[model samples]
Target: MPVGSITRGTTNTNRLRRVDRWIAEQPALRHAADPFVVDLGFGASAVTTFELAARLIRSRPDVEVLGLEIDPARVRTAREQLDRTRAGDGHFPAGLPVTFGLGGFEVPTPDARRPAVIRAFNVLRQYDEAQVDEAWRRMSARLAPGGLVVEGTCDELGRVSSWVGVTAEGPRTFTISLRRSGLERPSIVAERLPKALIHRNVPGERIHELLATLDRAWRVHAPMSVYGGSQRWIAAVATLRHEGWPVIGGPRRSRLGELTLPWDAVAPV
Candidate 1:
């Protein structure tokens, strides 16, 4: 457990805003009486955890959030952040619910209370690819029924990202979100894929094949370049659906440089 010294303990103000927004829109946590979310490996600061609570409370007012960190020092740092942000009314935009605790993948709580969402971004990136599946299983096993585990990576600036939406049942979907400008290729996000699929971005891998398909579609849709990158991405996604990629959602999400697909389409084969 203490094999690694500790993570770099890095975090930003709104590093995870997009994932928070997406989670807030989901039906699972919308009606939860005391829907609890956990920010696993919250690094040295729990700002994003607080931000997640602030945003999600708009939809599920009864929700509470807890930031979990493995490093004792990082936990102390998060406690300090809590002290600074001290939530009451204006702590959040409109009085959101939030809190934090110290725990690991085991969640180490006597109450045995599993959370509704466990967000672990940029956490597993430090581990080898082989370690990903076991880590995911260990964490997801601690989720409440219908709970989700969002595991992924993002660029330093949070512009381009990809994550896996895993439920207690197993992994369900994969979503890639990006900013539209200066984006060379949709596969550029391959670099941001979760640990499970990052190294799998090679020939003979499901994700590799999928990204290659998207790249080819992007090239084929190059004629639509004048319409804007978003439009070109939309066309490329359409080509994926036509080729049986099991793509989900419509132009609404695609317009925002997002592409969602069923898990098996890109699941490790």
Candidate 2:
């Protein structure tokens, strides 16, 4: 049986753009022989799943995307939406390489083909924090070689977001993404941390310290905001890297309001 409960079913067309862009850049998806991606628990609508396929195909033209929902009713709803799109009433190219299935953390794909990348945004937040590891294990076990599980959450409208990159070996990195322009402070992303580190954002925890340091850097670089939010964000991230925070990515990514660090740097206590 599928392994999760129904989520709030809340989602929008571009609600997952941040993560989708990040996933498209990953070597796992770009280099796979037959890239297959899964949008796990893609809530209410298959819009994000279709969006994911559209974005990924730019890197791997033959890429296939599957939208998996544990709820049979949701699976049905998504299929109906797919039908509409195929009928030319929607924006998607007719017969886009996307499908909907009934499954959960188990990630049951038709023909049992392991996916090259599984994007599980906003799914695990519904589970108890303690269940994250097991869920990760289950999903990772279904990954194709060099595959990844990109799990995270984003606020409504896709502005502030965070996700952890997990592989069959283990969790690799944590990334925080903001909208840049209206971003108040880096710490605002704390609310969207992936399930593994959300509760660990309390004082004394590594994740907490990481956010605190970023917030401090943001404030210190407030003057740079006069130039632009991107400059301010770049300066703040540069500060974190200078202070030996293991910040990953360069100006190109930083200018986009994204900061990534090895998972070890912010793993839960």
TM-score of each: 0.90, 0.98
Name the lDDT of candidate 1: 0.79
lDDT of 1 by residue, 92-185 (tens): 4433455566677766543777788888888888888877777788888988887888888888778878899988778899999887777778
Range of the 10 consecutive residues with the lowest summed lDDT in candidate 2: 1-10
Per-model lDDT = 0.79, 0.91
Please, what are the lDDT tens digits per residue for candidate 2 over residues 42-68?
888889998998888888889999999
Q: In angstroms, how far off is 107's CA in candidate 1?
A: 1.9
Query: By TM-score, who's the top model here?
Result: 2
